[model samples]
Target chain A: MRGRLRRGLLLLVLVGYAAIVVLAAWRHEIRPGWLDAPGAVARGLLAWAGIPPGVAVFTADSASAAEAKIVDLCLEVRVVEADGRVVRLHPDAGERCPAPQPRIWVKGEEIWLDRSAVSLRAAVAARRQELRRGQSARATRLLAEALAAHFRARAHAEGLAPERYALLWAESRVDTNTGERSERDVALMRWGPVGEGDLRVSWRPDASLLESHWPALETP
Target chain B: MSDGSSSYTGQGVLERWLLGPVSLQVMVLNRIVLGGVLFLHAASRAFELPRLYGEAGATWSPAYRAWVDAVLAPDLAAPLLALVAALAELSPEMREVVVIGLYTVLLGSSLAFASGLFTRGAGVVAVVLHMLFVTIHPFAHYGWASLVSPLVLYVVLSRAGDHLSIDAWRRRRRGLAPLPAEAPAWPMRLLQIHIAAMYFHTGFARIDDPLWLEGQALFEALARTLFTRFTFELHVWSPLLVLLTWAVFLLEPLAAIFLWVPRLRTLCALALIAMHVVLEILTNVGWWNFIMIAGLLAFLPPPWVARALPGPVPASR
Candidate 1:
């Protein structure tokens, strides 16, 4: 009887362990994805609180431009890849920004970028080409708002639709025809690979007229 | 050399109790398995499920960057370390190299310790090995690895391997008698307790995560599969998964204690192994879960597998 009891207790315990392992098979999905909902909330909160990803511009004239047209070129841009790999701009985004890379790296392969790291000029130029290429009123306005944000905090203004468009543009590439944004969120979750962390960019100002644009990535 | 003779004194007393047929079987079986699992996990990395994983990892994975940093510096230290781990695990063309060279060396060392041959030397090797190959694979590591680290250190430090191992086999072969002394009852205790911590820690840690609570973690994993997208095809599994998730959380620690008693440990070990097999089918967590189960299987009481083998009387008998 004692032996039987021991066996019975043992059987119970084994059954319990079996139950746990079988259930744990799905443990990774039982919770909200790490940083999924929270990361979005953090960005939104920062925006509402008027806290951006902390951009700074160098002032030559040394004037406080509340409306000082500033195009803080990203000196160092970090792009967070879908699989969590980060592609970084080499040579710093300063004097010579090494060409953009496709935020991807393979183990045995030589490392190269997919595209030259996107510069502020590139981002703006991309925006311009996108705007001209796309010809949607919505597209134009989004590009314009992004341009305005580069100028000064006070000068930055947006139409509701355009602001949404700007956010979309920041998120993914815009389609030329349907005006639809790429499903980057879906892409991220689908391929949502994360390893590389943080991409950096340097913004270069367009011209002297926009010299108030002090369009340079300077850290304060 | 001393003449080999049984130190077991009381003929009737030994005959009546542990020196009987059953007890001897347990000792031998335990020795073989513990050695085998250690060697196999390290040796199999070159091919099979784990190889596919290594290839996928070698792909432009964004997720493995941190792991890459840990294992793959361009320099020798990191790369060599990774290579050693890899060669031990994968080298398919050299399967024999790993299986025989590496596995035999380590298992032989473990056997020496177990059989009281060179107890301290074998203990040191075991501790060094478990530390090097076990804990640092953060991406692939799970709760069980850390739990066993200290216990293994203790086993080596205190000389548990001095008992029923190849060391004993050699001693008997060298005209020395088999050891009447036994492996401490405590390694059984240590394993049981350690596993309890492992299950409880994992189960509890996962409880707060929204994925575990909602049972979405598994669904999400399933969603990733080409055959079954969790959204449509895998959704059928969603309803039942929540209850199943909760059940797993409760059972893991309980299974650890089951090791103390004989019958229960066997069933539990089987259950754990089966669970790993099923998980292996469902997800691509690599070989971590399998290796962990293999390690835990070492703790199974000896008599169960030995029943199949020809064996002599039990130790106490």
Candidate 2:
């Protein structure tokens, strides 16, 4: 009789538990709004536990603009200024900025951005396809380098002396799932006086960035 | 003690079907493995506490906040929101230090639970800490964590420290006889149902997607080399990829049901384990595959565990 009682109670609890799991799955797949009640209960528990609530939401079009938002990652940037004023420039409307994401590292002079989201083949294919179709004449280019060049061209169009401002290469990516903006410095190149300069760009390896960020990454 | 009905007749057929004798060893083994998984899970995230949870961390997602505000009562959301707001006042260095400190506490609690030292208290604290950590960041939490959260809750309700643990060893040293090796059937039953339900829901969910139906889901997933162990340039193998995709889709619901059958249970368990292993190798799902593998271990009968250990099995009380 006792054994039967134990089994009965265990069965009861297990069924109750299973009901909750199945109901949750159903809610998640079918009636997601139903979860709000439980979520509210949980939040109340968390509130009772003394966790603060607030969302981290911000926008960044340039590396300097992302400085205050750099949380757990280290970003290195060399901003170029003319006459103590930042050569502020924005991307053309609807174009993704070339600013790097929050996670980046500096190796000597070159900054390597973590491009985990983009494949080299895809980037190369997009670039080739754009050029092949003569779509480069369009207002937008999907290639990062091409987008950076457009921004640099914009800076020149603003009448800033080329030699007076260092070229800031912002590596930016909007997270596809969340639409969150993350931008940082990829590479910065110094130029000579306007109309008398040869372009030389520095390239860094993906693994090299790991070495620079390892120390800070140890705790974060 | 009777609630006005005989124990046999009062319980419905469904109740009798659900309740049965299960090997205690299965529950104990699950407790140990699940605890270890939880420890490792917490440890891995400890390294990213600041970016995941602190003020200086990634943007506090608006979507995450809105969901919390809308679903949660204001009283509950207020304190949580207040805590998040308070982080802004801390200096960056101080914030990092505090985040590190919190992660350390979580890790230590997890370790204690895994080792079965003060199992109930430590396990309870660990579960609470884990739930809090889950709430801290939208990105930091994942499906595997959510799945394990309930098991951890069950762990606290269990006499999981009765065997294969520091608590058990100490009890033996103090002249107490060890608990009978066989555990009540409910824990394993709960786990079995949980796994089946997961597969059932997910399997059904995938069938509705055109990608799975058309057989391009696995192939498209494999094309992204980031998650896979290797890349194949085999354009000719599209048919095989589709077959593999259908196999997964069919196997899930089948396994969920057949896992309860005596004749088919072992086969289903083995196949499910293989699926998880193949998925693990083919994808970069982190601890998810490991968690599933551990959960699957409950399918092993208690006799297997008892035969391997040195102690003679105590007669069922």
lDDT of each: 0.38, 0.54
- Per-residue CA lDDT of model 1 for B230-252, tens digit only, reads 12333346577666665565556
Alpha-carbon RMSD, each predicted model = 20.1, 13.2
lDDT of 2 by residue, A124-151 (tens): 3323423333332110112333323322
Interface RMSD of 1: 20.8
| Collision count for each candidate, in order | 77, 25
TM-scores, one per candidate: 0.40, 0.61
Candidate 1 ranges beyond 4 A from true positions = A1-220, B1-31, B46-120, B133-148, B154-164, B222-233, B253-277, B280-310, B313-317
TM-score: model 1 vs. ground truth: 0.40
Which is the leading candidate under lDDT? 2
Report the lDDT tens digits of candidate 2 across residue range B1-317: 23335545646545544543444555565567777877888777655655567554543444334334322323233443556556545776786677667677778777878777888888887776676566555334545766777777666666676777788889889999877665555555667677777887777656555556777567655543334555444345768888988999899878768877878877888888898898888887656777676666666554555665454544232
Reference-based lDDT, residue B252, model 1: 65
